[model samples]
Each structure stands twice: as C-alpha cells, then as structure tokens.
Target chain A: MLAALAFVAGWPLARTIWFGFTDASLGSLADAEWVGFANYLEWFDYGDGEGEWFGLLADAAWWEAVRNTLFFALVTVSIETALGMVVALVLNARFPLRGLVRAGVLVPWAIPTIVSAKMWAWMLNDQFGIINDLGVRLGLLAAPVAWVASADTALIAVMIVDIWKTTPFMALLILAGLQMIPEDIYEAARIDGVNPLLVFWKVTLPLVAPAILVAIVFRALDALRVFDIVYVLTPNNASTTTMSVFAQQNLFQFDQFAYGSAASTALFLVIGLVTLGYLRLARLDLGN
Target chain B: MRRAVGLAKRIGFWALVALILFVSLFPFYYAILTSLETGTAIFEPNYFPEVFDLRNYAQVLGQGSFPRNVLNSILVATATVAISLFLGVTAAFALARIPFRGRKLLLLTVLSVSMFPQIAVLAGLFEMMRFLGLYNTLGSLILSYLIFTLPFTVWVLTTFMRDLPIEIEEAAIVDGAGPWDIVRRVFLPLMGPALAATGLLAFIQAWNEFLFALTFVASNETRTVPVAIALISGASSQETPWGPIMAASVIVTAPLIVLVMIFQRRIAAGLTTGGVKG
Candidate 1:
C-alpha cells in the first residue's frame, strides 16, 4: 500500500516539482527541455513600471486571489470556530431530542460540496431567488442584490456558502472535545459557586484548546486549498480565485503545464510550511 | 427577575438550535421545493411547495447522458471504496501489527501524501494516465481517487486495529492460523464496523471529488455526478436549467444523506478519531 501511494502520490509530486523547472506542456512531455528556475523567475518577474505586471508575484490578479484566500480562511475559520463552540455547547446541554438535532446538523456537511455550491448559486441568484424575495419582504435589501455575480460581493458570497457547509464539521469536532471533558470539573466549579462565564473561561476554554487548535488548523489548510466551492460558485472570477483554482486553470484550461506546476508547487510549499508551523505550535506528536 | 432570566435563556437556546437546523437544511429543502416546480412556477419566488411536479426529475433522468453519469458515479465510488478498504486493511495490519522498520516514517509519509494539493499532481497524473492508456476512463478516476482515499483509510484503520486486543490474535495463532487466516477469520469479523465507517467515508470522498473528475475525464459519458451536474446546461446558452440542476443534485445527494443518517455515530467516530490521531 505504501508502494502504491508512492507510485500514485509521491511519484506525481516529484514529477510536478521536476516539471515546474522545465518547459513541459500537454502532449509534449517527451520533448520538454530542462530550464533552471525559469518558471520560478517568470512567476516572480515584475515588468518595467509600464505594462501590467505579468509575474504572478506582482500580478494584481494573483495577489487578489492570495488576499481572498487568506481573508476567506481567516474569516470563515474564526466564525466557524466560534459558532461551532456555541453549537457544541448548546448540544452538550441537557435537552430533548438532542441526538436528532445533532444528526440534523450533519446534513449540510454530508451534502457534497459541489451540490451545496450549486444550491447556493441558485439561492443567491439575483432574480427569482427565495433569498432575494425574503430579503425584500423583510426589508433587508432595497432591491435584489446579485450576490455572486458582482466583484464587490463575490468573495463574501463564497465565504457564506463555505461557512454554511463546513460549520457542522467544526461543531462536531469541538463537540467531541467537549465530550472528553469530565463532568467533575464543571461540578466542582459549580460547587464553588463560580459564575458560568468564569467557569467557561477558566476551564472549558483551556481544556478544549487542543481540539479547537486542531480543528482550526485543518480547516485553515482546507480553506487555503479551496477549489470546488470557488470554482463551482464563481468560475474564473478573479476576485474569488484561490491558489488551487489558479493552478488548475493554468494546467488544464490554459495548458501552461510548467507554469501551472510551479504555481501548484508554491501552493504545496505554503500548505506544508503552515502545517509545520501548526505542528510546532501545538506540539503534536504523531509517533504514538 | 431570576425566573424571567431563566425563561429568556431557555427561549434563546431553542431559538439558536432552530436557527442552526434551519440554516443547515433550508437549502436542500428549497432545492426540493424548486425541483417540484415546473415552468415559470420556478420564476415566482414561492417559499412553500404549492405545486408537486415530477417532470424535472424525469427530465434529468430521461434526458441525455444524465443517467449514464449517475451510473458512472456509482461505479467509480463503489470500486474506489472496495479497493481502498482491501488495501487499507492489509496496510493497516502491516503498519499496526507487523513491527516493521521505518513504520513511523511510512505512516507519516502516507499522511503527507494526502496533503499535497491535487493540482500539484494533475500534470504528472495526466501524463501517467495517457502513458498507461487509462486517460478518460473510469480507471483513471479510481486510481486518482486512491490518492486521497488510501491515506485516510490506512491511517484510521491502523488506529482502530491497534486498539484491538492482541490476545485474540494470539489465541488464533495458537490454533495454527497463518497471517491471512488471522486477518480473514479473526480480524475481519471484528473490523466490520470500522471497515463500514472507513469505507463509507471513502465512498463519500470519491463521490464528492470534483477536481480530478473534472480534469481527468473528458466525455459526458465518463463524467461523474459532480461534473455532470456542473455542466448541466439550460434549454439555451442564455439561461441555466436550475430546475434540472437541482433535481440532479437531489438525486445524487439522496444516497449520501441516507448513508449518513444510518451511520451517523460511526461516521462521527471515524472523523474524530482520524482528526485527533492525525
């Protein structure tokens, strides 16, 4: 199985890294020539202060994508974590039909990302969408707003969809952490007549910190590499393009294989470094 | 005042839960609602299911290549789950029980492989598929899906297997059982729930996968449900067939919802274990 993984994943990764440094394109791999750091250089090049910056680093579109991804990750993960904690806390409380409610929460998470994207795309449609109608009825919008079509709101629309689909995943993970907390801790705090807010701050937060950290890190990585939601919801929308989308567009749509590989490699490195940073901060040991 | 505060708090809690449930399910509920509306009925923003129409579902199923796409999705997902489980179980045993050298490194390597963005492998895998004459075939999808499926299956299954009692295996070995015998007779039965959980998760992953399914396959006949639904066009270029798209989305999503409902506990166990351990 390790050998299989190596052949399927490792070999391809190695090839991508190699191809990133070459002049490879579709259907011409055999005749592709080696170029040392040319692709990397081209990605970093800043044109003489005249024409639009062509290099990916200086390119406005790429920077917008990077900013969008970062903003998306920051906003969504934070909100999801907060909302997940609240939902987990509520579920942890003694309530009737809790199991049914818990199962209900997983519905969104179970729905395929693409399906949800399409669902939201339609729901956010400016014309004949229930959301717009509701907004109009409730006086939320002066008129029906094109949620996903305009550049100003496209990223926000995508973020809303992502948060909707993934907050359940976050809630469940945090709920698992919540379940691990012994009742005695809270019982003792209650006996001491500690305020609930104080108890949560002093006990619950510290105990669930590791789980929340893990959840946040994982979700952040996922958001950083987001493709399906953005691609399906806002295809080729420069404001909403992520690293994965950009790389895929270059490789498949535009057929700039080498340049695409370079972009992909850059994404890989970014994710790897962030993961390493997280591991170090969390002090997580995988050997066990 | 205290009783008032308590009542307010109680109301607040239920209201929050209701909001969560509504937000979680409203899209799918609306999708169903929209799917049941035919013609210009969809154009009217009616929240309630006023009319029941099966035409959209029939349109999606009876129309060109949608049924084939659904079949292809089922075929690829099932094959992926079967192969991933078979390999994952055996690999988990080796990694968990066999006491091999570099086991830790191998496990870490497996974990890392899953983290490599799929696009990083797109160029390479595309070349490889073409080389092996597997490009645009279900075989390409099965193989590529393994890139994501195998790693998590092996990781989670290994964690589960390591928790099983060693005495059971020892007792089997005392009865003159070989490794394969131990696996088939002793371990397989015990692993039913774990296998089901991991297999279901793998199936979902394969079903939901889009990047590879979009990039690797070309023909409409070969496309998976996601690509099919994504490419589902309207009567003309100017308009999108939202009705058919929602119908197809519901068709493809129904099985997943059923599976998740049936196996919610096990799925939760698998996810938490995988996340905490990894």
Candidate 2:
C-alpha cells in the first residue's frame, strides 16, 4: 500500500521537482538538458554585464495566477466557513425532518465538481442563462450580464460555484463537532437562564472552535488548489485563472512542461508551508 | 402579545429551514427543470419543469459517445473502489493494529499525500503514462486516481480498525488464525459499513475526477463523464447546447445522488472520520 502511494504520489512529485530544474518539453523529455534555477529564475546577462531576470518567478502571468489563487482561496474559504457555521448550527438545533434536511444539504456536496461547474456554467450563460433572466426580471440587473464569460464577473462566478459546492463539507464537519459536545453544557446554560444567543457565542462556538479550525485548514488548502470550477466555468479567462489551471495549461497546451513544473512546484511550496504553519500554530498533533 | 411573538419565532425557524434547503438544493432542481425543457424553451428560465420532453436526454444519450463515457466512468470508479478497499483494509491493519519502527511517520506521510495538488504531479504522471505505454488507456486514470483515493481509504479505515475491540482479534488468534486470515476472515466482515462508506466516497472521487482524466486519457471513447461533460462544448461559446449539457449533467449526477441518499449517514460519518477526527 505504501508502495502504491509512493509510486503514484511520491515518485511523480519527485519527478516533477526534478523536471522543474531541467529544461524539458512535453514530447522530448529524454532529450532535455539540465538547467538549474533557469525555470524558476535566472539573471540573463547582456552586453557589459547588464542583466534582466527571467523565469516562472519573473513571469507576470504566473504572479497573476498566484494572486488569483490566493484571493479565491481567501474569499471562498472565509465565506464557506462562516456560512457553514450557520448551516451547522441550524442542523444541530431541534428540527423536524432533520434527516431529510441533512440529505438535502448533501445534494450539492454529492454532485460531481465538473457536473456542478457545467450546471452553473449553463445557468450563468448570458444569452439563455436563468440567472440573467431572473436578475433582469427581479431588478437584480437591468441587462443580461455575461457571468463566466465576462471578465469582471468571472472570478466571482468561480467563487460562488466553489462556495456552493463546498459549504456542505464544512457544515458536515462542524456538525460532527457540534454533536460531540455534551448536551448537558447547553442544559446547564439554559438552567442558569443564560440567553440563548450568549450560550451560542460563549459556549457553543468555543467548544466547536477546534472542528471549525480544522475544517478551515482543510477547505482553505483545497481552495488554494482550485482547478475544475475555474477550468470548466471560465476557461481561458485571465481574470479567473488559478495556479492549477495556469500550470496545467502550460504543461500540455503550451508545451512549456518545465516552466509549468516550476509553477506547480511553487504552488506545492506554498501549500506545504501553509500546512506546516497551520500545524504549528494549531498544535494539531495528528500522530495521536 | 407573547403568543404572537411565539408564533413569529416558530415561523422564522421554519423559514430558515426552508431557505437552507432551497440554497442547498435549488441549482440541482433548476438543472433538472432545465433538462426537461426542449430547444427554444430552454432559453426561457422557468423555475418549474415547463415540459417533460426527454428529447435533450435522448439527444445526449443517443449519440456522440456520452453513454460510452458514462460506462467508462462506472467501470473506472468500480475498479478504483474495489482495488482501493482491498489495498486499504490490509494497510489499515498494519498501520493500526501493528506497531513498528517509522510506522507513525509512514502514516503521517500517507496523510500528507492526500493534500497534494493534482497539478503538481500532472507533468510527471503524464510522462509516466507514456513511458509505461498506459497513456490514453483507462489504466492510466485508475493509477493516477489512486494517488488521492488510496490515502483517504487508508486513513479512514485505519481509524475504524483501531476502534475495533481487540477481544475479537485475541479470540481469533487463539483459534490458530494467522494475521492474513484474521484480516480477511475477521475484520473484513466487521468493516462492512466502514468499507461501504469509504468505498462509496472513493468511487465518487474517482467518478468525478477531471484533471487526471483529462490529462491522461486523450480519446473520446475513453473519456469519463466529467471530462465528457466539460468537453461537450459548442461551436461558439454563446451557442452552447444548454439542453444537452444540462441533460448530461443530470445524467452524470443522478446515480451519485441516489447513492448519497441511500448512504448519506455513512458518507457523512466517513467524511468526518477521515477529516475532523484527524
């Protein structure tokens, strides 16, 4: 089992990192020559030792992708966490048909990412989009606005799709934490005549805080590597181009395999650092 | 006055529940509604199913390798789930039940691998596929899909395995059973629910995987449903066949919805066990 994981994940990752150093193209991997730091950054010397930097690190598009990925991660994770908390709280409350409601919530989570992306893409179509039709009719918009196709609304569209699909996951995790809390804590608060709102703020939130923290890290990392939604919803739209999309596009489409590997390696470094920093700050000893 | 306030509170609670259900489920409802509408009627965004015409469904299902795509998805997902569970259960026994040097580190390593971005390995996996002559074959996807699915299955099953009462295993040992026999004959049966949940989740993950499917497989015949739906583009972006696309989306999501409905409890449990419990 470890062997499979090593081959599938570890070996490929090692090869990817190595490819980052060598100037390899897609078709002719065997013929590629080693050029350390050239893919990441290199000071190209000119006449009289005047030089300019060039590499994946120096590329404006790569940085734009980084910014877009971070922004998407930040916005979507924050919204999903907050919204998921609300949903989890609701689920935890005494409600009729709770099972049905819970299953209903899982619908979005259960749907395939690509299918949901395509589903939203169809609904966000400016010409025949339900969103545009409803927006115009309900005074949400005066015109039929192109959603995923338009530059201005494209990133927002991607975030909206992501948050919609992922909030259920966050909610489910938080709900599990909520269930883990002993019911008597709330009972005591009620006996003391504590305000329900205060019980939620001072009691419930603090107890479920760890689960929320873990869920945040999980969702945030996943969001940072967002690909399918952006790729399907707003393909080739520069405004919504994320690191994964940008890297994959270069890897195969543009045939800049080595450069794409650098971008990918950069992304891995960011995620790795974030994971370590989070593990450190949270003191989450998974070994336990 | 107090009675009126109580009434308002009750109304508000129900309203909130209704809203949650709506936001959670409205898009799928809209997708089904859209799928039912035919040609030009699709342009009109009626909230309800305006027509029950199956033409769009027929159109997508009848031609253009969409059904073949669905079959490909089923075949790949089933194999992935089967192999992952088979491998995962054994790994879990070793990781959870046995103590060994570097075991903790190896377990953590498996956990971290699940966090890997698919793009990070795409270039290399693509090359690996070509070198092994598995490129464009379904085998390439199954192998790449394992990178994500295997970790989750192992982690979740390990958690489940540790929680199993040791008395049963002790009794099995007294019956002169070896470790392999204990795992295959003893714990395997006991892990039925956990295995089902983990396998379902793994199946869904494999079914829905797009990045690897798109990167590894190159032919129309080998395309899974996700990639098929994604590649189901029109001549102009504006002229996209929404009817067929929505139809295909619904088709691809239907079995998953059914599976989730049947196993929602187990899946929810599996998801948290694999995630928050860590």
Candidate 3:
C-alpha cells in the first residue's frame, strides 16, 4: 500500500518521462502524435540545410545551455559544500547561545527562493540599490553598478542569491553528520599527537565521507535543475538561461512545445546520469 | 601552553560562527531594516536602522493580496500534508511491512520517480490539470506539488517504518488485531515522530513551492506566498516595490523560521537521516 501511494505520488514523474519520448503537444491526447526519437533528434539540431542529425549535433545554443548548466552546478555546489562544511565545523563546537544561533542560521533556508531572488534583485538593482551604496562606500568599486542588467554579472547575481539561501541547508546537513562522529575518535587522534588538520584528513574525512557525498550529490542535482532563481531573477536575460529555464522558455514563453519537451527530456537524461553516478559513489544499494 | 591553545580554538570557533550567522542573516535583516525605514530613510547612506515604522508591513498586509495569499498558502500546504501523509504512510506501511511480489521493483520505481525532474512532467501535468478541469484551482497546485512531496514522504516514512521493531507488531497480531488495528494501535503511536517529521517536510515543500504554483494557478485566490511575491509586478512600468516585497517576504518567512527554531534538532536529524544511506 505504501509502495502504491509512493507510486501514485511519483506517477507524474513517470508521466513526464514517458511523454518526453512522444510527440505530445498542447492539443488534446487524441491529437497527440507518436513520434519516436523525433524529440530526441531535435536536441542535436544545428539549423543546417541538410535537416539531418549531423547538423543537429553542432547546435551551439544547445551546447551552451549544457555548458552553462554544468558550470553553474559545479561552481555553486563546490562553493556551498566547502562553505557549508566550514560552517558545520564551527557550529559543531560548543558555545554560548549555541542553540539560539543554530536556529538563527536557518533563516536563509526558510525564506522562499523566489522571495530571496526578488530581494537580492532589489538589493543588486543598479540605480537606487543599497548594494551599490555599500560597495562604493567600501571602495570595492569606483562607481555604482547594475548587477543584473549585464550578462557578465547576471548569472553571478543569481548564484550569489542561491548560495546565500542554500548554504545553510548544506551546513545543517553537515552539522548533523558532524554530530554523529563520536568524540572519542578525536580524543584518540589528539592522544596520538595528530594535528587537527591531519585528524580531519585521516579520521573525520573517511568517517564523514558518506554524509558529505550525500549532501553534495543532492545539492548538485538540485543546482543543475535550478529554474526558479534564474527565472525570477533574469527572465529573458538569455545569458543566465540554465537548462530548465531554457526548457521553460521553449515550452511556455516561446510556445515551441516539441522543442521544449526535447530540451526537458535532455535535462532528464542528464539528471538521471548524475543520480546514477551518485548512487554508485554513495554505495546506495538500490538492490536491483 | 595547552590551556592557551584550547582557549584560542574556542574563541576562534565562536568568532567564525558569529561571522557565518551574520552573513547568513544580513540580507534578511537588511530587508526587514529597509522595510521598516521609510522610502527616503533608506537613502541615509548607512546599514543601521534609521526610523522604525510599521507602514510597510501595514501597507503590504492590509492593502494587498498578501494576507489572502498567506491563507491560500496555508490551506494548500495543510491539505497537501494531510493527503500526502495519509497516502504515503499507508503505502509505506504496505511496502515496508507487507510481503508481496514485485515489491523490490516497486521500491525502485518509487525511488526513480522521486528523483525524476519535475520539468519532465511539467507539460504533461499542465495538460492533465486542464483536462481534469482543475487548472487555476488550489486542488491543481496541491495535486501537482505531490509530485515532489509524496515520493519523499513515502521513502522517508518507509525507512522509518522499517527501523521499528516488528516484535511488538507481532505481539499485537497475536492478540487478534487486524491490519487496520495494528496500524492504528500498534504502529501509529510509535510512528508519531516519523509522521510529524514527514508532515513537516511535506508542509515546507508545499509552502515554498513556486514553479508548479506559478504554472498551474492563474488567479489571486489560488496564488501561494512564493508565487504571489515572485510575480508581484507593480502596476504599469513602475519598478517592484522593495519595501512591500520585503515586508511580505518577512511575513511569509517568519513562520518558517519559527518552525525551524522550535524544531531545530528534529529537522536537522530528519534531513540527514532521511537523505543519507547507511
């Protein structure tokens, strides 16, 4: 029964994957055309006169979306993982008002992503924003800058907001992992004259490897699928278009239903591959 | 020398922790600070709070769709939690405790579904919503949001269910208890924490959901907090009002913060234990 309920819950996912291979369109299901491999074929198009797969493979825009999505995922996940680990280490230590501070740290995580994006968008506004005020005051820049208007800074601004909101989640997960490490291991390491760094590298690292992998893998998958932040922050800004945003653009905004489904199917494949890699690294025995 | 090193580590740790907290909180604090300051007061050229006023909060709360949206969000999230939990717990119990063929394949399917991208289903889901005559309704968003929450609830609850001792359940069976009775009497009480944790996860996921809500609901009555604030485009070509947005943002965030603050340890344990495989 539990499995059934889970299945019902996940039926939408199956519906998504199944429909991706079809020529489903905005029209009714009766009007749905079955076009096997046609959607996938469109993913590789290069806009050539040949109208063949050869031309499709050279599509720069598709490649750019892939590159941008992967780059964003890699940078954001790596930075958040590193910073989150540091936060975990620091917060793991006993201190005054520790509980209070621990709870306070979740403020960012609790804020909705859209609201966070909008708030940061306001702060990063070029003209009357306080970020420019502070940046100029602190001598970080010679003049006030509009952070979201330019291609160079648009992606970075989105990344900054995401990092701000999600790093606490990373920290919280790592902190939970940290707490599970018995204090005696560190004591033994200290008694053996192991420096904290070596103790971390040898003792803590191996012990916490599974948890860290889980956190990073989850965060990475989520980051790769990022849509809401980029969509709300830089809608139609082309430069900040991640794969999901690109898919949405093709589907809803542009009304290119087939093309959008193709892009979404590609994203599914990429995420599926990542999830496979994660399962392998974490040794999660799906018991296949 | 040893004492000095220990003291330094403590101080260093506290300072670093404080710095992290500040950076984590600065934007929200600044938002609330800016919201409290009158429009011109924000131009005073400093990060400090100038004159505190409730005008922004009042304006957003009383004069906009924010309060109504909050109620809509609460209703949608609460309904989502109830329905997902009921179905998820039942399914989890069946999967975890019941002996049935194809269970392994079923479990794998559940896991895969849980991880599949929502976008993959977006077009189909949108079509389904329209077909079912649920488009632009709270029911539409609630059902759609389940695509994310249900698999998680079932997966996490199964894990929790699997960990519970079966001997007590068997003893109850010896007392001639039926499956429903066993679930109600023997298991439900024992699974309180698991249920609470899963329900909390479901609620938060629903509350913070944006994409489906954005796509599915097209009316003010159905818009959730995230979508409401996200799509808060001002009238005409005027800019987004940061003060009201922040005020609304703060209002929506306050409850979640309180939830985390009260359930800090439980939530942390829930996330780590729920996600990580042994």
* Candidate 3 chain B, poorest ten consecutive residues by summed lDDT: B269-278
The model with the greatest DockQ is 2
What shift in Å separates residue B99 of candidate 2 from its native position after superposition?
Answer: 1.5
lDDT of 3 by residue, A82-161 (tens): 99888888778886788888788877887788878887887888877778988998899899887998999988998898
TM of each candidate vs. truth: 0.95, 0.97, 0.91
| Per-residue lDDT over B1-278 for candidate 3, one digit per residue giving the tens place of the 0 to 100 score | 99999999878877887798888788888888878876777555457876889998998888767788999999999999999888887888899999999988887776666566668777767777887899899998887777667777888888888999999989999999999998889888998988887788778888988878988888887789998888776676466677788888889888888888888777776776555210
Candidate 2 C-alpha lDDT tens digits along A1-288: 988988898888999999999999988998878999999999999978798999988999999999999999999999999999999988988877888889999999989998889888878888878889889999989999888777889999999999999999999999999999999998899899999899989999989989999899889889988999998988888999999999999898999999999889999999999998998878755444
Query: After aligning candidate 1 to the native by TM-score, how far in Å is the CA of B244 from where it should be?
Result: 0.6
True contacts kept of each: 0.72, 0.81, 0.57
**Model 1 CAPRI rating:** medium
- Alpha carbon deviation, residue A117, candidate 3 (Å): 1.0
Q: Residue B215 of model 1: what lDDT?
A: 85
Q: Name the candidate that leads on lDDT.
A: 2
Worst 10 residues of 2 chain B by lDDT: B269-278
What residue runs in model 3 are displaced by over 4 Å at the alpha carbon? A1-30, A35-59, A280-288, B1-4, B43-45, B102-105, B276-278
Stretches of model 2 off by over 4 angstroms after superposition = A48-50, A284-288, B235-238, B276-278
Better of 1 and 2 by TM-score: 2
What's the ranking of the predictions by TM-score, best on top? 2, 1, 3
